[model samples]
Target: MTSTPAFPPLKTYLTIIACALLLGGCSSGDEPASEPPRVALVEPLQPAEPQPEALRLSGVVQSVTTTQLSFEVAGRIERILIDEGTRIRRGQPLAELDRVDYQLQLSEAEARLRQLQADLARKRTLLAEGILAPAAIEALEANTVAARVARDSARRDLERSTLSAPFDGVVARRLVEPNMVVAVGTPVFEMQDNRHIEVSVDLPEIAALSIPLGPELKAEGQLVIADVSLPLRYKEHSTQPREGARTYRLVLQGEPPEDYNLLPGMAMRVSVQRPPRPQASQDQFRLPLSALQADSDGGHYIWQAADGRARRLAVELQEVEGDQALIRGDGLQAQLPIIVAGGSKLHEEQPIKVQERN
Candidate 1:
C-alpha cells in the first residue's frame, strides 16, 4: 500500500505532458521566418557601334574562260587525244575524225584540178596557133578556175577533220568516245582556262546595290577555300537579275596560289565588307533577344538593375539580326546593368540579388 501511494495516475500524467508541449509550440511561433533573396543574372548593355557590315555569302569557283569545243565537220571520231582533266596548249591537237574519206576526197579533187590545168594549157597553145576557137578556150579557163576552188575546199575539209584546242586550257569533259559518230557542231569536249579563275556569287538586290561601281573598285572581298583566304577583285555584275529570281550574279576574279588547284564548280565562301551606311545612327543597344520582355499593352521592354531593384525600361526594337535585336530606348546606356535571366518573375521595386555574368 505504501509503494502504490508514491506514483501519480496515468491519465493525469498524460494531460500535464500535453499542456507543456502546447506552451513550447506557442513560444517558437513568436519569431517570423526569413527567405533568401532571389538571384538575377545580369550583363552590361552593349552599345551598337557603327561599323562596316560584313555580308557572308556562298559562292562557286569558276574558270574565267569556259568553252564548249565542237567539231567543224561531221564524221566518226577516229581518235580522242585528250582525256578529261588533260592540260592542253593553244592549237594543240585535241581529237581527230576518220581521215580515210576526207583523204580520198582531196585526192580526187587534186586529180581533177591537174587534168583541167593540163587541158587548159593545151587549149592555150592551140589558141595561139589559131587551131582552137576563142569561146572554147574561155570555157576551158572557167573549168580550170572551178577545179581550183574545189581542190581548196577539199583541202580545208581535210584539215578540219582534226580538232585543235582554241586556247590553253584543261579538258573538263569528254562527251564522245573513239569511233563514235558525231554531227557537225556537236560538243565533243568541255574546256576551261584554269590559269584565270573567277568566283560567282548570287546576291540579293539589296546587297547588290551596296557595292561600289567603278573601275577602281579593288579588294572588296575575300574568297575562302579550305580555310585559305584569297584577295578578290570585282570583275563584273549582271545588270538583269538572275533568271526567274530577284538575285543578281556577281563575278569576282582572284589569282589562285601556286600550290592550289582552284577548279570550276568548287564550293567556297565569300565575305564582302559593305561600305558603312551613310547617316546611320549609332544610339542603339544590341541586346540578346531573350533579354526583351513584352508589356500588357504589347509594347516591348527590358529590365535594368538599379539600386538592387528591378526597373522597367521601355525600348523600341529597331532591327533583329540573328539572335540579337537592336533596340533604342530612353535611359538605356552601355554602362547600365541589364537583367538577362530570372527577370520574368521580377516586379516593380522588387529586391534582387545580382549575379554578374562572366
Candidate 2:
C-alpha cells in the first residue's frame, strides 16, 4: 500500500480510462467532414442555323368570298343536284323544290288571261264601232292588264322554285336533303370561292405597323403547308383589332399554285419577311423551348455549357414556332451546346457532367 501511494481500486481505474476514451471519440466525431458535390448531367447546345431575320406566323386558309344560299320561297325540296365539295358554275342548277303547285297556279293564271283578252278585244271593237260606251271599254282594258300581271307573277314564282348558283364556287355545305320541307329564306347551301383564297394572319399591333400592307406593297409572303410553299400577295390589313386580342388581321390574297389543291379551313404556316433594315442583324438561332427560362423582370435567359460548366446568358426571345423558340442574343454561336433540360435549377458556372442528350 505504501509503495502504490494509496491509488484507486482497479475497477475505478478501468472505468475512468473507459470514460476518457469515450470522450475523445465523441470530440473527433464532432469535427466537420468533406463531401463531394452532386454533378448535374449536361449536353452541348445545338443552336439552330442563323438565317435572315424574319417573323413566321400561323394562319388559316379561308375563302375570300363565301355565301350562304337560301331558298327565296318556301317549299318541299324535290331534288339536290350538287353535293358538298362539288364544283359549280354560275347559273348551275343546284337544287329543286316541288313545283306542281306553282305549275297549276301558272296554268290557271294563263287561262284567265285568255278570257280577259277576248273580252277586251270584243269591247274595243264595239267601242270603235260606237256600239259600246268608252267607259265600258276602259273597264275591259283594265281587266286585261290585271290578268297579264297575274300570269307573269305566277310564272316568276315557278322559276324561283328551282335553286341556281349565283356565282362560280365550290359547295362547302349541304344543309338539306331531298324532300325536306324548308321555310322561306332557309339556308340550303354554303358556297365558297376557293380559287381565290385568302390567308388571314393575326399580328400584334406593334408588328402590324411594321409590315406594309395592301396590293401596292405586295409584301413577300408564302403560305407553307406540309413543306409546300406557295407565293402570296398582300391584299389588305384590318384597321381595327380583333375581338379578345390586341392584334390586327393581315390578309394575303393569292390563288393556289398550279395543280396544288387547297381547301378552306386547312391550316398553314405563314411567313412574312420584311426588308431587313441596315441596322438589324440577320443573326438568329432556334432552340428547344425548354432551354429558355423567364426572369422576374419579364426577360428571358438561357443556360449554355462553357468549359464543363453551366453558363447563364440573357437572350431576346423573338418568337416561338412549334416546339422551337427563336432567339437572338449577343455572341451566340451555332453548334454551341446549351442545356435543354434541368436548367431551371442550375446556378451560373455550376459544375456539370457532360452526357449525350436523351
Candidate 3:
C-alpha cells in the first residue's frame, strides 16, 4: 500500500522531448525564422614553403670610385686623346699642351749651363796659375751649379705639357677638347673606375642593424642583373636622423657584369630575410583571414564541423600576414575540419554544412 502512487507515463515525457528537438533542429528552406545563410567552407591554409635561402633588396648601382682628371700646366690643349666614355690606361696620355714655350726655356737654361761650365774650367786653371783668388774660383763653381738647377726645372715644365691618366678608368665626361684653353689644375675629364661596382640601399635603422656584414643578399624574381648572384661585403656605415627617426646607410660590392653594360645609377630591388625564431617555427595550422571568429568575452575561436555537426574551438592567433593568419589552439590541424568560408555568419556550437570555398 505504501509506494503505489502513480507517476506520469514514460511515453508522454518521451513525446514532449521529441517535439522540442523538432523545433530546434536546423531548417532547410523557408522556415524563415530558423533558416541560415549558405557560407563558404575553407580548408586550412599553410604558409608558403621555404625555397633556397635567398634575400632580396632594393638598391641603385653606381661606380666603385670617381676621380677628376686635370692638367699640371696651364696651356691650350693641343690634342684630345679621348672623348666621353672612352676607356684609358694608367699613365696613358689623355691630352697634350703646346710645348714650344717650355722647350725654348729649356734651351736657354742649357746654353747658360754650357757657358758656366766653360767659365768654371777657366777659373780653376787661372786659380792654379795664381792669377785668380780661391774665393772667386769657388764663386764661379756656385754659378755653374745654379745654371744646371734651372735646366732641370725647365725639363719638368716640358714634361707637364703631356696630360696623363693617373689611374686606369673610363673618361666619363670630357670638359675640354682639342685646342681648348685650360688653366693649370683645370679638370679636363671626369673619370670613373668601371671595373668594380657597388649596390647601395636605404633601410630603416632597426632593419639595417639586424643585417650582418657578409650575409648573401640575393636578387630574386626580376632584377636588372639577371641570374648572376654575388656575395656581399659590407662597405660603408652612416647614421642620420630624420623626423626624429634614425636610419643607417649600407653598401655592398660586386664585379660588373661581363657585358660591362652595367651603368651607374641603375636601380634594383632587394629583400632581406628575418632569421627564424625559436618559437616561430612550431607545427601549427594557419587559415585565411576570413576564418577567425570572436566571442562576447573578446576571445578568438573558429567553428569546427564534424560528421555534419559543429563544435566551437578556442583558438589563438599568433600573427597575421596579408590574407592569411597563423593560429594555434586545441585541435587545429588538417585532420580536424573547420569552416573558413562561413566564419563571419556562424554562432558557437551551431550546426554547420561544410562546403568548399567559392
Candidate 4:
C-alpha cells in the first residue's frame, strides 16, 4: 500500500543529519594546509677590508752548506776517527788512509831527488873545472828540476791520504769503513754546516709574482720542534719554476735558538705577508662558509634575503680561512642579509623568515 513512508522520529532525523554534516566537515578538513615559510639564519654581508694577505706554507729545514767529502788520493782506509753525526772543526782530521804506500812513494821520491841533487852538484863542479860542457850542465839542471817536482807531488799525495774537514760542520754520513779501499774522488763523508740553517718553501708562481720588490716582503718562521718564532731574512729564491711544478723555491735564513738544536730535515712553518690587491679590495666580501652553495655544474652561489624571500646570487669563491670564506660578486653589497644556515634547502625566490645572527 502507498501508505505513508515509515519516517524516523524527528529527533532521530536531526541526529542523522548532524552526523552527516560532521563527516562532511572532517572530509573538507583532510586537505593539506599551506606550510609556513622556512626560517633561515642570516647575517649581514661584511666587506673585506684591505689587509695584508698572510700566506702560510710548510717548509723544510736545510743546511746552507752541504758538501760531499772525498779523498784526493786513492788508498785503503786505515783509521776513521769520527763517525756519523760527529761535530768537527775546520781542518780537523777526520780519517786516515793506509799511509804505508804513500810514505814509501815519498821516500823513493826523496831519494831520487837527493841523487839528482848530488848529480847536479857534481856536474856543476865539473862545469866549473871545465870538465862538463854547458849543454850537459843545463841538461843535468833540468833533470834536477823534474825530480824536485816529482818529490813535491809525492809529498802532496801523502798529505792528501788523510781526510780533513774543509769547514766546521757535522758529519751527516760516513760511506767507507776501516780497511775499505776507496778510489780518488769517491765520496767518503757527507758534511753539512748546521750553524747556518736555512728554510726552504715552495711558493706558487702567482704568489711569488705578487710579492713587492725591494725588501717589502716580510716573513717569519716557527720551528715545529719549538714554540719560538724567529724573524727570517730572505736568503735566495730559485729564478725558475721547480721541476714539473708551477712553484718557485723560496729560501730563508734565520738564527736558531740557543737552547734548541735546529738540524737539517726538521720542519718549519713560514708565514709571508703579501700586500693587498687594489682591484680586489672593493668587490670582496667575507662570509661564513655555510653561506656558500654549489650548483650541479660546480659553480658557487649564495642566497640573499630581500623582501622576505631568498634570492640566489652567483659568486666567485676567492679564498677560505678557517670558517669564513672570501667571495666576490657583481651585485653583492655590504649590510645585505645573507642566508647562511638554511640555504641548502631553499629554492630561488622561496619565501624565508630570517633570524638575525648576532
TM-scores, in order shown?
A: 0.59, 0.60, 0.58, 0.61
* Regions of candidate 4 where Cα sits further than 4 Å from its true position: 1-53, 213-216, 243-245, 276-358
The runs of at least 3 residues in candidate 1 whose Cα sits more than 4 Å from the true structure, single-residue gaps closed, are 1-55, 220-225, 242-246, 273-358
Question: Once superposed on the true structure, which residue ranges of model 3 sit more than 4 Å away at CA?
Answer: 1-55, 128-131, 213-229, 242-246, 271-358
lDDT measured at residue 152 in model 4 versus the true structure, 0 to 100: 98
Error of 3 at 324 (Å): 18
* Residue range 282-321, candidate 3, lDDT tens digits: 5666677787887789888887776665667888877776
- What lDDT would candidate 1 get against the real structure? 0.84
For lDDT, the strongest prediction is 4
lDDT of 3 at 117: 99
Q: Once superposed on the true structure, which residue ranges of model 2 sit more than 4 Å away at CA? A: 1-54, 219-224, 273-358
Give the per-residue lDDT digits (tens) of candidate 2, residues 1-358: 3565677889998999999998998988776664333354444544554434466788888898899998888899999998899989999999999999999999999999999998888888888899988888777788889999999999998999999999888999998899899999999999998678888888887777666665544433444555556778887778899999999988887777666667877787877765444423457777888889899999999988777788898999987867788888987877777888887788877777766576
By lDDT rank, best first, the candidates go 4, 1, 2, 3
Model 3 residue 133 distance off true place after TM-score fit, in angstroms:
3.3
| Shift of residue 78 alpha carbon in model 3, Å | 0.9
lDDT of 1 by residue, 211-279 (tens): 664454444334454656787888888889878999988888888777767877888788777875653
Using TM-score as the measure, name the better of candidate 1 and candidate 4.
4
Worst 10 residues of 1 by lDDT: 214-223
Q: What is model 4's C-alpha RMSD?
A: 13.9
Give every collision pair in model 2: 44-337, 45-337, 45-338
* Candidate 4 local Cα displacement, residue 200, angstroms: 1.4
Q: What are the lDDT scores of the predictions, listed in order? A: 0.84, 0.80, 0.73, 0.88
